[model samples]
Target: MKGFKFAGIHAGIKKNDQKDLGLIYCEKPSVAAALFTRNKVIAAPVILGKEKIKIGVCRAVLANSGNANCFTGNQGIEDARACSKMVADCLDIEEDHVLVSSTGVIGANLPMDKFKTGVPDVVQQLSEDNVDQFADAILTTDTCRKIVNRSATIDNKKFSIMGIAKGSGMIRPDMATMLAYICTDIHISADDLNKCLSAANEKSFNRITVDGDTSTNDTLMAMASGTSEAQINDAGSKKIFQDMLDDVCFELAKMVVKDGEGATKLAQIIIKGAQTKKDAFKAAEAIAHSNLVKTAIYGEDPNWGRITAAVGRSGAHVVPEKIDLYFDDQALVLKGDWQGTEAEKKTSQIMKNSEITITLDLNLGQETDSFLFCDFSENYVKINADYRS
Candidate 1:
């Protein structure tokens, strides 16, 4: 966390005077790597940041919420560029050294006048203790800010990794309307950092789902300041750094799901004994994305039929008679046959908990995969319906 400064302020981008702008700056240019949304309709900041990050060096990250800065054509791109330039000029850094990100409703333009007046003040207020404020500023519908810290010691050298993320809805496996900024004090190359970020992301962001929607503004960026004196140039040291980074990202991802809009329960769908790992993930994703299954979980109903039906249509190779299901270790179905009313009663009780695991086994092969998701509730519908209001 050292060598990094953060600032968050109300830049008039949101209507309620909430903090809508956040800045993360390093003492010097740092090795940077990033991943953006896979959505075809990408946002303006994403288009610009994608090119800047390819240079593998960055000194600052500027983000805003409440206006997505998407679909406004050339003006949106110019606005993103102008914002980056403002931050760069204020901080005495190159415009290309700054990465920009925005999240909120689609089809709205960024209010450049706000950034024109606010970026300088934000730069002046940057402090190491304001990370919580930055985290809050990046949120749109998220109920709480997600921040995670991790440290690792390798060969007597200590390294710190801190990550902040914001998300509540429009979530899916390919990423969500989420924005994650990760900063570390370790010394590592951009290539190695990218490898670590991608690998960590696969097990974290890529496995979480809220409403099965991938946002156009989804992004996860990582920067290493090289302040720890720990050179992660070897396999063993790289593994240590990767593991710590993975832990930070995984914790943040879980926070996003736990704070999912109108979410009452966090469920882990574990698929095992599939014909292949891909098939396992397919079945898990299908079950996790099922509205019927999510609503049943919300209502504490042990609807095994919905689960099996989702898996059957997931295109995953499975023998119906060889399937088994469990709700938090309580068997609901054995070899594709219902265990009856008593089992359902116990499974329903399991669903009452804030967190539960749904495990499915296809007695067909040995590959497996898992996904983290949340239950759907009436409030979710209400939240989206009144989002713009």
Candidate 2:
């Protein structure tokens, strides 16, 4: 935050009046690390970002919403590059020092004219206080911006880390989720920053789902400005930085789910006591992505059978008779046996809460994994039905 300036402007690319262009400018060239979508058909910006991030140093980020630069063949890359040039020229930095990103409707060419006019104006408005605007500009169907910050102190030297994210739907990530950008003022090498980010992401962005659709333009990146003079050359300092990074990333990830399109409830799916971590994750992923399970939560229905069926079909090694399920502390199924109508009624009450946890005890080995997700609603359908109109 000390070395970063941000801006967001209405570029007129979106149908409404919301800001469509965003910028993140670092006063000094900063160490950078990035992860992209696992979707084979990635957007042009992702292709370019993969190349740019290899240098491990960046001066700026140019991102736009409402027009995902995907599937436009060679032209898409050119457009993404051209947009980067606009920011670089305006900021008086080398073109290669700028990273680019986009989100919104897929397979459409960027309206270069909108960017042509919008880029310069947005760049002129950059300031350290403009991060909220930058957050807004990167959103698609998200109801609100997601931002989290944490601080680490070592020997009285303090450093701050800030994370900003934009996502609502198409939120499952194989490696990265939606569009997340992290900035910190800690003095750390690019390799060290990459290691910390990779670890933090596995526990955060990689564990959330909305509609189970991975975006073509998913990106998670971090930049370290070294402005705070808090070096991480040793394990002790690194651990402090890692803890702060993890908390910021996890909080932003939860905000993304809570603001998910048409979502009314935020829930954590925990698969505990599994034979292997893989099996735990497999069952949790299945339950998180199941429409029946999500809709049942939305309707406050005590439909434990949907949850049972999902775990059974998840390909996870499980002893059917050894499974126990609960909504919060109210057990709906105990050792594969229903707790009956009275318990169902109480479980229904748990489901009505804005936030709750679903725990599945496999009664197997000690390995376990978890996921964060939100309930599905008819508004989710309505929101996506005319997303392009």
Candidate 3:
């Protein structure tokens, strides 16, 4: 944290005249790990970044929002490389030592004039205390900044981890629909860092959904500078670090869902008593991604039928009559039967709040899983439909 410098600036790429460029630079090379979207039609920066992260060390990262460099074919790749090379030449680092990422509207060409003008200003203004500005620069439709920081002790040595992310729409994640950067001061090998990062993302980013549409550009990168010298070289140490990293990523992931565009309610879809853990997650995600369920939450309508229907179509084995559902503490359906007028009233009031929970019990086994999601509103449609305009 002491040696890392961050900066953000408005480069005239974003139409709103807000900051859309960011940089995170280390005085020296740092061990890095990253995850990108599994979508076949990926962005140019993501394709370039995968190769850079394979080098195991990176000196700086350049990211831009409001114009994703995807689907422009070979020109897109050239543009992405040009951005990185510009940073490398200016910072005196090798081009391969610089990583690049982009977010926002896809299939558009990058504005080279902005990069030629903005990158230098950002480099000049870089400082150790610009974490907030860096977080703000990577946003697309996000309503607020998402950040999490933690300090942990391993082998009597203390280390710090800080992460920031931006994504609010086009958010059904294969890796994650946005971009995130996590920095730590711990000493861990690149292989170990990648292992820990992949494990952490699977259970956190893979479980959440907003609109069920994955983006063409998505990346999550983690860097450990070994500044703390808290060596995590053994299996035991690796497990501990992995757990802590998962907790950090999971919190930040939920923050993305809670701040989802046009979202007025945060909903937790809990599926329990399934015969298998896979079934639990499938059922939970299906419910979370359902438009009917989201609209119901938006209107403060305690529609238990939508919940049951989603569960049934989730392809999970379940007996409807044996199932139970709840909206908050109000049991809307008990033993798969409507709990009547009083329960409906309670659920209606619960939906009016900013946060709500829907629990489904299969009454089969103990396997369970849950997902964090937000309700769909008119704003979500308006934001994405008119995004480029």
lDDT of each structure?
A: 0.93, 0.93, 0.89
Residue range 1-389, candidate 1, lDDT tens digits: 79999999998889998899999999999999999999999999999989999999999999999999989899999999999999999999999999999999899888888999989988988999999989988989998899999887989988899989999999997853379999999999999999999999999999999999999999999999998888897899999998999899999999999999999999999999999988999999999999999999999999899999999999999898999999998999999899999999988888889999999999899899998999999999999998988
Kindly list the per-residue Cα lDDT of model 2 for residues 10-93, writing each as its tens digit: 989998999999999999999999999999999999999999999999999999999999998999999999999999999999
Residue 258 of candidate 3: its Cα lDDT?
A: 91
Could you tell me how far off, in angstroms, the CA of residue 341 lies in candidate 3 after the best superposition? 1.4
For residues 298-340, could you state the per-residue lDDT of candidate 3 as single tens digits? 9998988998999999988889999999887889888878999
- Give the candidate order by descending lDDT: 2, 1, 3
- Give the runs in model 3 whose Cα sits over 4 Å from its true position: none
TM-score for each candidate, following the candidate numbering: 0.99, 0.98, 0.97
Q: Give the least accurate 10-residue stretch of model 1, judged by summed lDDT.
A: 173-182
Assess candidate 1 and give its lDDT: 0.93
Clashes of each: 0, 0, 0
* Superposed Cα deviation of residue 149, candidate 2 (Å): 1.3
**Distance from true location, Cα of 366 in model 1, Å:** 1.1
Would you list the clashing residue pairs of candidate 3?
none
lDDT of 2: 0.93
